[model samples]
Target: MPYNFDDEMIDEIREKNDIVDVISEYVDLTRTGSNYKGICPFHNEKTPSFMVSPNKQIFHCFGCGEGGNVITFIMKHLNMDFVDTLNLLASRVNIDIETKKTKRNKELEDRNKLLFNINKDSAKYFYENLQNNKKALSYIRERGIDESVIKSYGLGYALPDWSGLLEYLLHKGYKIKDIHSLGLIIQRKDKSGYFDRFRDRIIFPIINNRGSVVGFGGRIIEKNGQPKYLNSSDSPIFNKGYNLYGINILKKYARGKDVILVEGYMDVISLYKYGIRSSVASLGTSLTENQVKLIKRYGKDVYLCYDSDEAGKKATNRALEILKKEDVEAKVIVLKDAKDPDEFINKFGLERFYETMSNALPYMDFKIQLYKERHDLNISEGRIDFIKEIVTELKKIKSPVERDVYLDKISKETKVSKDSIKEELKYLPIRNYKDKYINKNNRDNNKDRIKPVINRLEPGYTIAEKNLLYLICKDKNIYESVKTQISPEDFITEEYKKIAERLYEYYENEEFLFKTFEKVLNDNLIGTLENIYNTQINIDASQKNKVLEDFIKTVKIKKLENKKVALKERLKEIDLMDSKSEGDVEKFKSICLQLINIDKELKLHQ
Candidate 1:
C-alpha cells in the first residue's frame, strides 16, 4: 500500500528539502555562479557536467541527459520509486503522512492479502507432500539440490491425485472457489467439481519482494507429462510478466553486481546452488519491458545467458532489443558444449562457467556473429549480403572510430574493401541496400528502390508548438487563451506534447512554479522540460501577443497541411487499386470533401 500525497503536500515536502542540501548527501558539489556544479553520479564522467540550480530547485546532467527536481534526484540516485523517495524525504523533514486509501483500493488490498494467504497455505501443503514422497525427494536430490537449498526456495511437490490439493485446502477450511481462482485447481467441464492443477510435479513457489507467496510454478516429474512446466495464471496479485523467478532472493545478494538473466527456473536455481547469487529467470515467457525495468532497478550491467539453441538465440536477440531500448547495458554469455546454464554448470563445473561468463561477448559482437550465421560468407553475393546486414547494425554506433573498427573487421572477414563498405554506409541514410536487394524480384525491379530521405530543417510549426508551450507555462493567462483555440494534442513533438499535457493539468490547481510544476513529470520527461526552460525567449512584452498569435496560426495551418497530405496519399492509393468497392468510393468522396474544407481552413490561417 502507498500513501496518497496531494500537490500541496508535495510542494511542502519539496520546499522543506533544498535541492543542494539533498543532493550534497550523495554527490560532492561546488558553487558555480548561481548554480552548483558536480561530477554526474548517473554516468561516468571525469569533467563535471552535472548542474543544480538552487533557484529552480532542479538538477540536470548534460552528459547523460538526466534531470529532475529534488524528489527525482533521490529516485534516480538511490534507485527508489516515487512513493518510496517521497516517503523518505518526508521522513527527513519529520513530516508525518497519514496513510489514506480509497474504498476500492482498500478492497483490492484485502483481496490480495487473502490470496497471498491461500498461496502460502498451498505452498506449505506441497512442501509437506514433498517430504513424505520418497520419489519426489530422490528426484530433487539427484538434481544435486540440497535440503537447505530446497528449504531456502520453499521447493515442494504436489501428489499425483487430481483432488489431492483440493482435498487438503478444503480440510484447511479454504473455499473451493477461492482455491480455484488462484489457478491451483481447475474446474471440470460440466462445472460439477474442481481438481488440483499441480499433480505429481515439483512445485516452485514464486515469492515477491516481501517474501509473500504470490504464485507457483510446477515442473512435471512424470516422464509422459505433455507440458513440461506449468505456472500459475494471472490473478489479482500475480502477473507472470511483471515478475522474475528467483529475483526476491537475488536482490539480497546483488550488491550492485551484474545480473545473470537466464531462460528457465532450473537455470537460476542451478546458478544459485553454485554460489552464483545474482541470477534470475523470466517466468516461462519472453523477456518483457517491465522485467527489464525491474532488472534496471537492481543493476545496470546485465549478462544474458539464454540457451544456445536457435530458439534461445532468438530469445536472446529479443531480450537485447528490450534492454537496449531501456538504455540498460547488456552482454551475452556464449556457452560451449552445454545448451543452458544448468547443464553447463553440471557438465563443466562452476569455475568453467565463471570463465565463460567472464569471457562473455559484447552485444555488438554477438549480433555480428548471429548475422554471420544467417548468410554464407564463401560466395561473393553472400559476403556482400553479410556486409550489408552488418552495416545496418554498424550505423547505430555513435562513434566514428568504433564504427570504423567494426567496418575493418567486416572488411577482413568478407574480403571486401573497407572504403567500398564505407561508401555504402555513407549513403545508407538515403538508401538501404538490403531493402533494395532483399530478393531477386526486388533487385530486378528499379521502382522498388527507396527514395532518398533528406534530413531537412525543422518545420516552422514544430518551433511554434514549442514556443507556445514555453509561453503557456510561463503565464497562466496565456494558457487560458491558448486552451480555447489549440490543445496539447496539436503539438507535433512528443516531448512538447507531454509538457503541455502536464502544464494544462497543473494550471487547474495552482499557478506555475518551476519546482511545483516539475512534480507532474516523471524522471525521463524532466530533461525535455529543463531544456525548454533554458531556451532564450526574447520577445518584447509589446510583441508578445502578436508572436503568440502567429505561433497559433502556424500550428493550425501545419495541422491542416498534414491532413491534406494524408488525404492526398489516400487518393493515390485508391488510384492504384484495379477496382474500387462502393465503400472505397464513399471513402474517396469523404476524403475529397475533407480536403476541400482543409484548404479553406489553410487559406484562413494564412
Candidate 2:
C-alpha cells in the first residue's frame, strides 16, 4: 500500500525545518536577501552559487544545478541512502515510518544488525583476550608499550584455540546461522562444525567515523604465520577504503587543530606516546575521498607525516594530490631521509619529531624543493625545466598573491625572471581575482544572475515571489491573508507550488520550527527553497501587501496564459480526429469557450 503524504504534512515539515538552519549546520550560509547563500558544497565552486530558500523550503545551486528540499539536501550532504534519509528525518519529526515488509530491506537490516552485534561482541571478547590472557602477555611486553597505553586505545587479543570465540558465542545463545552472518566465522568444508576465524592474534578494532566498531585488524604473534597482518573482510557495515584506523579514536583531539597523517597504526600510537596527540593512520590503504571528508569535518588542516623512505615519498605525494582538492591546508613532513616516525622516535626521540613537524614546509614549497634537487641549476635548459616544473605546481595555487610570492622565491632559486613567471601564470586555468570579488558587487550583474524563472523569471519577478514566500513562511497572518484569494498552484514553477502546498497544509502549528522541515521535505523542494533564499527581496511590513499582490497577479497571469494555450492545442487535437461526431464537436467548442471565460476571470488584478 502507498503511504499517502498530504500537503499539510509537507507544510508542517517545511514550517518546522527552515532551509537556512538546516543548511547552516553543513555549510556556512551568509544572509543574501530573502534567502542565504554559500559556496555550493555539492560541487567545486569558489564563488557562492548555492542558495537556500527559507520561504520556499528548498535549496538550489546554480553551479551544479542541484535543487531540492530539506530531505534531498540531507541525502546529498550526508551521502545517506534514500531510506536512511527517510528514517533519519522521520525520527526527528516524531513520525513513524512504515517498515518495508519486503524481503530485501528486511534482509539488509538484519544483516547490518548481525554484523553490528558481532562487532560489539567481538570487541568485548578481543579486549578480554588482551587483559590477563596469559598467551598474549609476551606479545604485549615485546612492543615495550605500557599497559595504560594499551588500555587507552582499547587494544585487545584473540585466543589461540581455533574454535574458542565461535564456541563461546554459540553458548551465549547466538545461533550458528547468526554467527556466520556476522562474518566472524566461515563455513567448514572438511568438518561438520564451525571454527574461530582469527586465532592467537593481537587485535586492533576498526571503528567507523561515527565511533562504532565495524570491523577488526589482527597482527600475527606466532613466528609460524607467514602473513604478519590480516584485516576483516567487507561485510554489510564496513568498507576498508572508507575506514581509517584512528579517525574515530582520535577525532576529538584532531578537531580545531591540524591532524598528523602517518602511514601505519604503530606510527599513530608512537606519536601519541611522544605527546603528539593529533595523529591518525590510514589503516593500510591510501588516504581516500571518504577519509578526506571525514578528516575535514574534524580538523581544519592536515599534516602528512608519512614515512620518509622512497615508498613513503610516493605515498606522501599521492596523499598530497588527493588532499589538495579539499580546500584545506596540507603540509608534507619529509622525516629527514632515513626512517619512519617510529624509527626516528626510537632513535632520536620525541623532540626531533616535534621539530620536524614545526619545520615542515607548505606542500607547494616542498614540491618545488623536490623538483629543484632533480635538475642541475647551473645549466640553462635544466634551470628552465625546473622553472617549468615548479611553475606548474605554483600555478595550481588559487591565491594569486601567494602564487607571486612563490614565483619570487623560484626566481631566486632558479634565477628565472619574476615577470616571466607572472606571464606564464596567465595560461593557468584559474579564476582571476576580479571575477570573484563579491563585496560592493555590481547591482546589475548580481540581480541579473538572481532572477527566478517563474520558469526563469526576470530579477524583478523573482524578488516579488521571494518576498511573498518569505511572508507566507514566517508569518501566519500573511499566509492567511493570501490563502483565500491566492493559490500557489496558480504559480507555474514547481518550486512555487511546493511552497504553496506546504503553506496550505501547515499555517496552523504554532510550535513548528522551520529548521526541522529538512527532515521531511524531498530533496527537490529543499533545493528550490535554497534558491528562493538566495534571491534578494523585501519581506518588510511596508512592502509586504504590495509585493504579495504583484506576485499573486503574476502567477494568475501565467496560469491563465497556459490554460489558453491548452485550449488552442485541444481544438487542433479535435481536428486531427476525423471520426468525431457532430455533437461531440459542438460540445468541444462549447467547453473551449467556457475555459476561455474562466481564464479571463483568473487574470483579473487583485
Candidate 3:
C-alpha cells in the first residue's frame, strides 16, 4: 500500500529534521562559516566538498554533485523510499503520523505485521525440530557448519510429515489461508485442507536488511530430490528478488568491506563459517537489479563467487552487465578444481580461499578469459576472431591506460601488434544507441527499478541543453528568455527533456525551490539535477544573452542531426530491400530530401 501524506504534513516532518544534523549522523562535518562541510559519503574524496546550508536546509556535494534536502539525503544514504524516510524522521522528533494513514494503507500495515509474526513463529518451530532430528544435525555438521554457526544463521529443519507445520500453525491459532499465503502450507488437490510446504528439508530463513524473516529457502535432505531447493513464493510482504539470503548478517558484519555474492544458501553459510563473513546469496534465483542496488548500499567493490560451471558463467555475465549499467564495480572469483564456493572453501581451507579471492579477475579481464575459452587462439582464423571480439570489448573501456593494458595482453596472446588492434578498434561500428541509452525503460519494469546511470560522454548539444537548464534555474529572467526559444522537445536526452518539462511547470506555478525540487523528481533524475546544479557557469551580465543563444542553437542543431541519422538509416534499409517497389523508391527519395534539408539546416546553425 502507498502512503498518503499531505504537503503540510511532509513540510512539518522536513522542518522537524535539520539538514546539517541529519547529514552529520552519516558524515563527519565541520563548521564552515554559516554552513557545514564534510567529506562526501556518496563518492571517494579526501577533501571536504560536501556542504550543508543551515539557512536553506539543503545539502550539496561539489565532488559528486549529489544535492538534496534532509529527506533526500536520508533516502539516498539509507536506500529508503519517500514515506519510509518521512516516518523515520517523524519518529526521531516524536511525531505521530498514524493520523494521515489511509484505510487501505492501515490494513496493509496490519496484514504485513501478521505475516511477519507468522514467519518468525514458523522459523522457531523449524529450529526446534532440527534440534530433535539427528539426521539434519549430521548433515549440517558434515558441511563443517558448527552449532554456533547454525545459531547465528537461524538454521532450521522441516519434518517429512505432510501436516507437521500445518498442524503446528493451526494449534498456534494461525489460519490455514494465512499460512498458505506465506508459502508455509499448500492446499490439497481435492480442495480439502492444507499441508506443509517444506517436507524433510533444511530451512534457511530469509531475513531482510530490516532483520525481519520475510521468506524461507529450503534445501532437500534427499540427495536426488527433485527441485533440490524450494523457495517461498513471493507474497505481498516478501519478494525474493528484493531480499538477499544472508543480507542481515552482511549488513551487521560488512564494515565498508567488499561484498561477496554467491549462488546458494549453503555457499553463504560455508563461507561465513570459514570467517568470510562479508557474503550473501541470491535466494536460489539469479542476480537482480534490486539486489545489485542493495549490494551497492553496503559496499562498492562486489566479488562474484558463483559456482565454476557454465550456468554460473552466464549468471556472472548477466550480473556484470547490470553492474556496469548501474556504474558498480565488480570482480569474478573463479575457483579451480571446485564446483562451487562451498566445495572450494571446504577442500582448500580458508587460507587458500583467501589467496584465490585476492587473485580475483576484474570484470573486463573475466570477459577476456571467457572469450579466450570460446575461441581457439592457436589457429589463425580463431586468433583473428578473438582479436575482433577483444577490440569490441575494449571499445567499452573508458580509461585509455586501462584499455592499453588489455590491448597489450591481447597483443601478447595472439601475437597481434598493438597498432593493428588500435586500427581494428577504429573500424568496429560503435553501438552508440545501445551503450548510451541502454535500459531507458528499466524504471518502468518492476523487476529492475534501479535507474541506469547517465553516460558522462554526452554530445556537445546535450551538454549545452543541460547548461541551459542550469542557467534557467539560476535566474528566473533566464528561464523566461529561454522558454521563448526552446521547449523541452529540443533537449535530445530523455532525462534532460523531463527535467526541462518539470522546470517549465514549476516556474509557471512559481514553485521552484532548490531545497524542495527533489519532490518532483525520482531518484535518478535527482542525480541528474545535482550534476547540472553543481556546474559553475560564470557569464558576464552583458554576455548572458549571447551564451543562452549559443546553447539554444546547439540543441536545435543536434535535433536536426538526429533526424538526419534516422533518415540515412531508413534509406539504407530501403536500398537493402530484395526488390525495390515503386513505393519504396518514393520513400527512399523522400528520406534523401529530408536528409539534405537537415544537413543544410545544420550547416546554417554551424
Candidate 4:
C-alpha cells in the first residue's frame, strides 16, 4: 500500500498525510473500499455518515454535510492551528524541516520537532534510570509500588548526578544544542556546558495517544529536595494544560466507559491498580480548552476526581470553566478526608473510590452546592443573588427543554418560580449571539472550513467567470480562447487571480479536471472549484464577449467592494485593539476613504 514517490520526499509526506489516516487517528473510521466512514465526531449523530477517502484524500460527512481534506480534518477535529497541522504531518513522514531558511510551516515543524524530541529524550532518561538505578528502585519500593506497576507505566528515574542524563544523551548521539534547546538540559549563560535539569527524581513518562512520550513528571526521591515534584516546562509538543499523564495508557478504558478524570498520576495508577481502569490525570496542571477538546473527542461522560485539598477545589473550578465551554456532561467526585483519589483509595478502599466515582455530582449541581456552602440561602439577599446567578447560567442553555429542567432544579433548591426564572432570562445577556450571526450568513459556507469571508461576486460575473474557468480546463477549445485572450494577471480579484493561476498550471499540464485539481489545491480551493464546475451556469454558449466584458467589470467592482469592507472591518479591529485612539485613527480613516474612492472608480469603469 505504500507507494514510492520517486524522490519527492515532501510529496511522499503529503501523500501519506491522507485525510483518512489523519482523521482515523482522531475519529474511529470504518473501511468502505478506498474510503472510510464514521459518525461525525464534531457533532452528535444517530447513524454513521462521516466518510473519508484515501484515494482522493478527502473526507465528507453527508449527515452534517461537513467535508474537506487532511489539513481541514486536523483543523476541525483537533481544532489545531494551520502550522500545527502541517508540523504534525511532516513529523509523521519523518521530514526534517529546518526552522530558519524554510517557510513558516517548516520553521514551525522544526520548532515542534525540537520540543517533542526534548520531551521524548527526557522521558527515555527517566525510564532508563527507573530500570537501572538503585536509588530510584528504593524510592519506588518505599512508595509501595510493585515492579509490575512501574513496568506497566514504563516508569524510570533521574540519577543523582546532574550531568548523568546529559552525558548519557550525548553518548546516545543526541545533539548537545538540541538537548539544551529542548529544555532537557540547563545551559549556563557564562559557561559552555549543560547539566541534567531533573536530578535524583523518580520519573514518569507522560505519553500521548499515539504512545509517544511527550513530557516528564519527576518526583523527588531525596528527602533534602524542597519541591516534592517537578514537571517539564511547557513546550510546543507538550502543554501542561492540555495533556493528561496516563491518557495514552487509559484511552482504551476511556473509549467505552464513562471516563474517570483524576487529579494526579498517582491517582490514575492507583485507580488502574484497583481495576478502575477508565481513569486519567491532567498533566500536573489545571484542565484547559485543549484538554477539554481532547476528552470530548474520546468520551462523552466525564467524572472529575480532584484532590480534596483547597488547591484541588480551585483546580476543579478552573476545569469546570473549560468543560462548560466544551458543553460536555461532567460530574465532580468529592474525595473526602484523603488528599487525592490515590490516598483516598489507599486509606479507605477501592469500594469507597468506586462509590465516589458512581455518585459523582453533576457539575452544575456541585457548583450550586458550592454556592449553598458559601451563602445562607434563607437570607433574602443571598437567595436573590443565588437565584440571579442560577438564572444567568440557566439562560445560557439554548435548548428550551434543558433550560426548563435546570430551572426546575433551581426552583427546588432556591424556591424561585420557573416563570420568574424565565422572566429573568428574558432580560439576561444569554442569547447565542454568535449562533444567530452564523445561522443568518453561514448557509452557503461549510462551518468545517474557516474562511474569513464568503465569496459575493455579482450575478453577471458568477456564472461566466466560474463557468468559463471550469469549461476552459474541461474542453480544449475553451482553454485555447482563455489562454490567448485572458490571463489571470489582468484579473482584478486577488482571490480569483490565485484561483486562475492554479487552473492555468493545471490546464498547461493537460491534467484531468477532477482528482488532479483536488490533489493539487487543498480542500477549500477544491470545494470552490467544484462549486464552480458543478453549479448551474446561467450564460449561453454564444455570449462569449458579453460574458467576458461583464465578468471583468464585476470582478473589478467586487474587488473594490471587498477592499472597502476590509478597510471598515480593519478600522473597527484597530478601534477595539486600541480601545481608544491609541494608534493612528486618521490613518485608518484615510484607508477607508481610499477604499470608497476605489469603489467609485469601479462603478465608473463598469
TM-score of each: 0.56, 0.52, 0.57, 0.54
Q: Number of clashes in every candidate structure?
A: 0, 42, 0, 3
- Total clashing pairs in model 4: 3
Q: Each candidate's lDDT (Cα)?
A: 0.79, 0.67, 0.79, 0.66
Tens digit of lDDT per residue, candidate 3, span 1-606?
Answer: 223555567778999998877777677799989989988766557988989999989776755556668876776577676768788999988888886556645766798899899999999999999999999999988877899998998999999898998888889998877887777886675778778878899999999999999999888888652457777865667765678889989889885789999998989999988888899988755566777888888865899998898657766776787777778879999999999999998899999998998999998899989889979999999999898877877988999999989889989989989999999998887453222111224323444444344334444566688889877776555686789889998888899999999889887864244434546787678768866764544443333566688788868876886788788889889999999989999998898888888888877764
Query: Which segments of model 3 are wrong by more than 4 Å?
Result: 1-101, 430-606
lDDT of 2 by residue, 1-606 (tens): 111233344345545666677677667789887889998765556999898888777787765556567876786567664446555666666664453234444755676677677778888888987886876877777666678768667778888788888887877767887676445776675658787767778888887766778877777788762346556654446655567777875675657677888877677777777677678877655566667777887776789888776456656766787788666569987777447887777677887777887888888877887787778999998898887777778768878788778887988988878998777756655432222212223433564563322222233234445657755554344666788777766656667677767756755542122334333467667656644533333222233465477666655655665777787777778878879998868968886887869666864541
Question: Which candidate, 2 or 4, would have the higher TM-score against the true structure?
Answer: 4
Per residue, candidate 4 scores C-alpha lDDT tens digits across 502-538 of 8888766542334345567765675466555443222
**Candidate 4: minimum summed lDDT over ten consecutive residues — where?**
432-441
Candidate 4 residue pairs that clash? 126-156, 126-157, 130-157
- Give, for candidate 2, the lowest lDDT window spanning 10 residues: 432-441
Candidate maximizing lDDT: 3
The order of the candidates by lDDT, greatest first, is 3, 1, 2, 4
Ranking 1 against 2 by lDDT, winner: 1
In the order shown, the candidates' Cα RMSDs to the true structure are: 18.5, 18.3, 18.7, 19.7
Query: Order of candidates by TM-score, top first?
Result: 3, 1, 4, 2
